[model samples]
Structures are given as structure tokens and as C-alpha cells.
Target: MARSLTAAIFATALGFSACLLNAAPAQAATGTITGLAGKCLDVAGANSADGTAVQLYDCNGTAAQQWSVGSDGSIRALGKCLDVTDNSTGDGAKAQLWSCTGGPNQKWSVSAAHDIVNPQANKCLDVTGNNSANTTRIQIWSCSGGANQKWNAPAGGDDGTPSGFVVTEAQFNQMFPNRNSFYSYSGLTSALSAYPGFAQTGSDTVRKQEAAAFLANVSHETGGLVYVVEQNTANYPNYCDWSQPYGCPAGQAAYYGRGPIQLSWNFNYKAAGDALGVDLLNNPWLVQNDSAIAWKTGLWYWNTQSGPGTMTPHNAMVNQAGFGQTIRSINGSLECDGRNPAQVQSRVDAYQRFTQILGVSAGGNLYC
Candidate 1:
């Protein structure tokens, strides 16, 4: 009898360990990206072909402007990223998106030089004579190797590269504000208080690891610093309506999927609310400010309760490993397909960039 009881206890412990291991990895809280905001972009079109209008929007979970920062330090978006626009060496030439031909234009080298010059264009991504002011639009100009052309990615800014780009803190904040903190979702305390599960994770190595994983996942989902100023209602109808008590109204059933994880659909909102103890039907902004709750909403689909054996956050990532696709599903995307090799590789590269910072290696494979 004693031996049988001991075996049962060991089996229960093993089951508990397995359950904990299956939980999503928490992401670290990355600080604001210092000076590479303008370099990032969104797809903003149905077909991600050549000449798609790659616009500069704040990364707020939209599929249009999501990007991948390559280890070689190239910025990729919309299948293709910002290249030197055919490697021109003339002034007034507009920077356009092109196929990842791996030419000199696409092959950017972020060196101790800090000069992001395109030999194809003979121009550098300059800062208007190096003036770090508000709303300072970056321009491509002659590559004289001046300080203005020289960029530095600061020690904290994890752009994968060791050196490149620098901007004022205020300007950087404008480019990348704390998502939930910026929208003001009745203070961080409310969101934290609403979800005790996250708090129970504890503030040790486990919590930090989880935070890093969560932040990295969401940042990838929301397009990093590029999505700092997106319209909350752009994806969902009642997404921004605070006046609604138990959802938008009789006719407004489409107002779901908001915040970093794009918490959408009434079913999803109520489900997340049930888990986090917040009325997500009424307060959708909780997905941003409250890190714990935000993660809860993002992870709600992971459990079998929502939809068993179907495409969910955990299963999709474990299999597909594309951040863009995960967000596209939650927000109802028409153009952004995360299953593409280019898209998946781009995000995988970004994940590698962060892991490099954290000093971990998947041994060439991102999926560990």
C-alpha cells in the first residue's frame, strides 16, 4: 500500500510538471527602440507584391506594417523590406520595397561605422542633418559618412546588431510607448488585480523568463515599436467604445479584437474576461496595460476549453512559428499570411535576435 501511494504521488507530480512546461513562455519587457523606428514599415495591402504601399504606422497589432529585423541587420516588411530602391545613386529618389534579392541594397551592414549607406543609392538614411527633433522624417541623402548618417542602436536597444542608431528618449517614446500604459486602461493596478494567475507566477527567474517570452511574442504580434500609435478601433468596431456597458450595442457585434494581442469576438472577450476577472466585453483596453491580463487574453485560446484541437496561439506557434499569422487570425486579416516562408523566417530571425541578447542559442533552430 505504501509503495502504491508513493507511485501515485510521483505520477501526480509528473503531471503537474508537464502542465507547467506546457504553459507559454513569458516574454521580457523590452525598452523603447531608440532610433530605428522610421526603418520599420507595414504591408498595408492585400497582395504583398512589389510596389505595395509600405506606410509608416505605429505598430499596434495591424498586419500592414509588421516587420522583421534580420541578424545581418536588414529590415524586412511586406515580403520585401526597405531596399535602396534599385540601388540608384541620385538625389530625390524615393526608397521603395523590393524582393530580398540579397543585393547590396538589401544587404545592410550595421557596423561601428553607424552609417546606414546604400552603395546602390550612394545615399544614407540621414536624420535631417542629425537633428533629433519631434516628427523628424528620415531622408536618404548622399553618403558622406557624416555623424548624421552614423547611427547607433544604443546598448539597450536590441536591434541584433551591436552598433547603429540613436534618438532622443522623448522621440523614441513617441515611436514606441508602453502599449497598455499609453492607452490608459484604468491604471496598471486594475489589470493586475483583475488577474491573479499571472501574479502567482512570482517575481523570480520564472516570471522574468515568462515576461520576456510574452513581450517578445506580443511585440512580434503588434509589429514592435512601429505600432505605437495605432487606432484602437481600426480592427474592432466597439474596440474603443467605453460608453458601452456590456459590449457596444444591439447592432455592434463586430467590436472585438483590440490591444496588443487583438482580443476580438464576443466569445473570446467574455472568455478572457472570465479568466482575468475583468469585463472584457466592456473594457477591451485591458489587453494592453495589464500585462498579466493581457497575457491571459492572449493565452485563452491555448486551452482546450475555447476550441479543442483547433488552431490556437500555442499550437500554431509550436507548429507554424509565425507571429504575423497568429495576430492575423485573431484580428481577421485578409492580406497578411504568416505561413509564408519569408514571413516565418523573418520573425524567426527576430526571435533569434532577442535570444542572442539573452545569450541563448537554439543551435540554429528557433524552436526549442
Candidate 2:
């Protein structure tokens, strides 16, 4: 919940992370990568020969499909690495078996959205032409966040609600029964692609706690999600800071609070928009008008900004530093340290209720 103080300033623009994966554990896991049409990613004909094609096949209990996602970012099987043929980064560059060379071409990242990406190519491991045949080849293609690009790789957290989101639509409605139609479940889930690590790190309890903490703050900020834009119009004109090189381009009063986090300030609009490729500085009203964009702004702040605290809110919950740290990160200057105990309690109560809904303990350090 970005408040009016300079403390509310959300910082930096992350266009796309170098790797969308959470940091791999000391020993990355070895398993079969299930892909399109429920097939296993396989080495063609179970052959170990160099340059053998990597394709999709029925899930047989065979060593040909057995593979490992290494901590160093290599996918290995059949004593060879999954390689982009000839080290090409171009789209449609086919994947094949090659001896492990520790080259950039073989580097890949599996993200929270179930997409396996080749970072060097900035592309997803795609089924050629979206085919479901047994021998359909694998290739690198521009990431579209499509099902064709998704993979059920090792190391996924089972934190999602029944709808494959951290929070179910039913739970969301229960949390914000009076929430405006502007905040849609689909919109929020769609925005998760921008920051793959949110609610995806650490143990299952930690994941649920992180989700609860973020939404608790959002629930308080929006008054149980009833407000789409800031209710206090008096602060509309006050949010525009004149010192930035790109002065308030959306007019002085346009940068007021909006979205789940009620993101405000000219610099914050620029930062969130730039990070999301949305041009929010000029079209600041989009946060209130577009549900997905509105949700994206909130995620952008949660995942990237430290605000008045030492770490981002995402880090606070994942590191098990308690929900109090999230409150400090968001509005400590005005609300924490007994300056405004009532407001902090409002946030904590929501955290407790939300965690109960999630079937998890609220954990320690309930207040700042």
C-alpha cells in the first residue's frame, strides 16, 4: 500500500529478469520434463548418439528421458546436454543432444508459469508447430506464455489454489466480497507472469504466508477492495513531483493512487509502467481502467521495491521475517513503531484471517 509520503516511492524498472527461476537449491533435481499433450521430453529412439533429436514421447520408464536440471543451468540426459544446435539463438533453432560443453547455448531456466526458457535465446522450449505427435521436435521460440511453451519440470511449489493460482476465486471473493468488479481473478492470475518468484519460493507454509501477507496489505489499502482508485481526491494534485527529468506528463493531478496497491507518484508510474512495458506515465488512468494492468502495478511494487524498509515485501515473507516486516516495507514511516498502531493492527487482522482461509498458521511477529 503505497502511501503519500516520499517513503511511498517505488524504485527501479526490471524489464525482465535474467533468469525467472528462483535460485536453485544446492543440488538441483533430476526428473522427466512432461510437456505438450502430456508426453515426456525424450531423446529420439532412446539413442545416445550425439546430435540425436530431443522430442516428445509417451512417458515410458526409460533412461532416455531421465534428465537433470543442474544448479549451473544445464539440462542433461543420456550423458549429453540439451543443446541449441550449433549454439544458435535464433527462433526455430532446434534442440538436440550434445556433449556437455558448458556453453551459453545450453543454458535454460524454468519459471513459475511452467515455461522452460533458454536464457541465451530468450525463448521457450516449444513443441514444433504445437504438434502433439510422439516425435514432434523441440525448438526455441519467442515466449508467448502459451500452453505450448509450458512444461511440468522439477522443483515446482504446490502452493496454487485449486484454480492453479495462489488464491482461488472463491477465496478472493470471500476476502473481498464487496470488491469492485475492476479487480478480477483472471486479471490477477494473468499478471503473475511478470514476476515468477512471488509466492513461489521456500516451503509450502512460507509460500502461503507470503500470499496472505501481500493480500492482507492490499485488503487494508483498498478498504476490503472496495476502492478502485484513491477515495481521497484531495491528494490527486499532490502526487506529481516536479523534480524528475520527465515531469508529470499525465497532468499534475493524474498520478494519484490506483490499483490493488494504489500506486501513486509520477516517478512510480514511470517505473511501474516501464518495468511492465505499459507506458503508465502518460496513461496513468489505465490502472483504474484495466484490471490486468492494475494488478500488474501492484505486483511490480511488491516484487521489486524496498520502499521505506530494507527489503521488498516479497523478500520479507519468503525469508520468514514475519508479516510485520512487510508492513514496515510498505508504510513504516507513518504507521509502524507505535506511530499508528491501529493501522498496523488492521493489517495484522487481515493477515490472520487470510492465513486461516489458506489453512496455514499466521506465524510469529504479528506487529511492527
The most accurate candidate by TM-score is: 2
Evaluated at residue 351, the lDDT of candidate 2 is 96
lDDT of each: 0.40, 0.78
Output the lDDT of residue 54, model 2.
96
Which stretch of 10 consecutive residues in model 2 shows the poorest summed lDDT? 9-18
* Alpha-carbon lDDT of model 1: 0.40
Best by lDDT: 2
- Cα deviation in Å at residue 237, candidate 2? 0.7
| Residue pairs that clash (backbone atoms under 3 angstroms), model 2 | none
